[model samples]
Target: MTENPGFLLTVLAFVLVIGPLVFVHELGHYIAGRIFGVKAETFSIGFGGTIAGWHDKRGTHWKLGWLPLGGYVRFAGDMGAASQPTAEWLALPPEERAKTFQAKPLWQRSIIVAAGAIVNFLFAILILGSFAYLEGVPRTPPVIAMVAEGSAADRAGMKEGDRILSISGRSIGDFEDIYRIVRFSPIEPMQIAIDRGGNRLSVDVTPGVLVERDRFGNEYRMGQLGIGKPPAVYDDIGLLEAPLVGAERTWGIVRLMVDTLGQVVTGRRSVKELGGPLKIAQVSGEAAMMGWESLIGFIALVSINLGFINLLPVPMLDGGHLFFYAIEAIRRKPVPVEAQEWAYRGGFALLVSLMLLVTFNDLTSFGLWQKLGGLIG
Candidate 1:
């Protein structure tokens, strides 16, 4: 309720964060449909009972809903934006059927379905690129300032004044990259290339366990190389080069996310790291508290995440729709309607299961169960 400050902040942050992303995604679909000559019937920002709405010049019902969880856009002949043709859709006169989504050619349909995710990725690129243009690219050179005595770096023959060039074959852009990699990889040893004066040498270092405390008085274990970087410096970024730098930055996140998913599939990563709405809301609230710049950066990261996740070729996703289109293209005809229904059903179930898992993970992250146990014990 609104009386509970923390609770209200979380809810508000969740709505604020999810609202724009979903609006942008649906806008992509809506715009693409208009470009391709499909009539959009309704553009709603949420589900269930409508709170406020009006008809537009284009004969589209634009409305806000009471539920703030998710949103959709329904075209003239779409059962929904998923664009599956239904019996009602089929019952339309031949003249009316011309405006239906299924009437569009395969290529157009594919583009429309994929537009939401593509726009999300583009949003991230623009956000990051703009930051780069204004603030410049971080070029900290990864030089070590001091190595903790008898710590992981010291034990691995690392010395002070060493300039790190790369880790595990990946070039280190900044000191933060080193921290992220080290923190994520606990068991793996890092093969690092360094520049010592004029000599280029390599070293292998296993990260040591470092217990840390957060503002919440919560304890966490992160990997420690026991090495610190020198003062920060940034590269001179031009307006033209800013977007390219941003794309490169976005690509890095995409690669990391993909690799993380691969690790999960291979059982090398814990599924508990998966975050749903609750985790997102918490992060959003934290970012909001931090300041506007932090919140903007968080939004950019989430946009990239939304794009990447939607592009995964899973059922009940944008990628899933595209997957069926690919099959249809190859088969020279649509997959049977019965088969599609079954596939969508399966996809919905998969999504629901993932939602439940991530919600449980969020609860655990919040220490809800632990607090309850403490109460009971």
Candidate 2:
């Protein structure tokens, strides 16, 4: 496989992208545990059988696993990666129990559980901030340079040289803002405020549906106004302001994700739009080919996604642990072990089903079944 440069690059890119994110996630838990005087029994990158391992001076078994999907940090009382408490560890001597995760205070345990996702978000912020600080931020004015003939913008009486003031009552500061609003509102009527030659005017426009395909043959459907913007100007951002810019960008992505998920749930979007590891690998390879800046940007984007997904209130995830903690906090006691076990079991099954669905989508997107059928025929 190493001899095949393209194949090797793809594999390498996938590892490079996933490995650090997983490590950072686990590191967040490990660091939080250490801060609370909790003992980490093992810190492993990846899961299942160990490919290589060693014991650290702090009695932490550090290992690289054969499976490179995800990783975990097992505290003293944790029975598995999900951080379920073990009977033996719980029954240990008082002195030893004090150093176990389960023995920690409710607030401490909640922080420990939530640390992984928080760290992922922080990682993305740092990356994005650094990019903005170094390369400056792109600022494109919301001025229409062109309107497609007979398209939505043209039919709505939108003309070139018009400066967009707002959409749906929301202020528009940049051309990208217009794209963001219009992209999610295909065929939806919107009241757009514009300034034409210093004359304030309001126009009603319905965005047209636009379908696009990437080099990988993946399809994307979105709304378009069929309007063009002038060239963007790069504005140098201050060191302090860079992080704020990054945070805003991160929030924007989260909002988009939330909107997309809502659309999917409302049957406005197809479930086929969901992607899995295969899509990540493909995108990683493509980003790598586009140079370090693009690849690093993609990493930041993926990191935000990882953080967002982990923070979801689903069982067997970081958010799930926090959910249980929330319940424990309110009840003034932990939930029964049996109830937790059943919940975890259901969560596991749900996760597995989702994985299978996304994998099927990935395969279908790649036309794998069609190719196999052609061969069989």
lDDT to native, each model: 0.83, 0.87
The candidate 2 region of ten consecutive residues with least summed lDDT is: 1-10
The true-structure Cα RMSD of candidate 1 reads 3.3
Q: How many clashing pairs per prediction, in order?
A: 0, 0
lDDT of 2 by residue, 184-255 (tens): 878778899999999999999989999987655556778999999999888999999988988877887788
Runs with alpha carbons beyond 4 Å of true place in candidate 2: 1-5, 80-86, 157-162, 165-171, 184-204
Where's the lowest-lDDT run of ten residues in candidate 1?
Answer: 1-10
Candidate 1 global TM-score: 0.88
- Which candidate comes out best when scored by lDDT? 2
Looking at model 2, residue 319 earns an lDDT score of: 90
Candidate 1 local Cα displacement, residue 352, angstroms = 0.8
lDDT against true structure, model 1? 0.83
lDDT at 250, model 2: 86
**Model 2 / residue 232 / CA error / Å:** 1.9
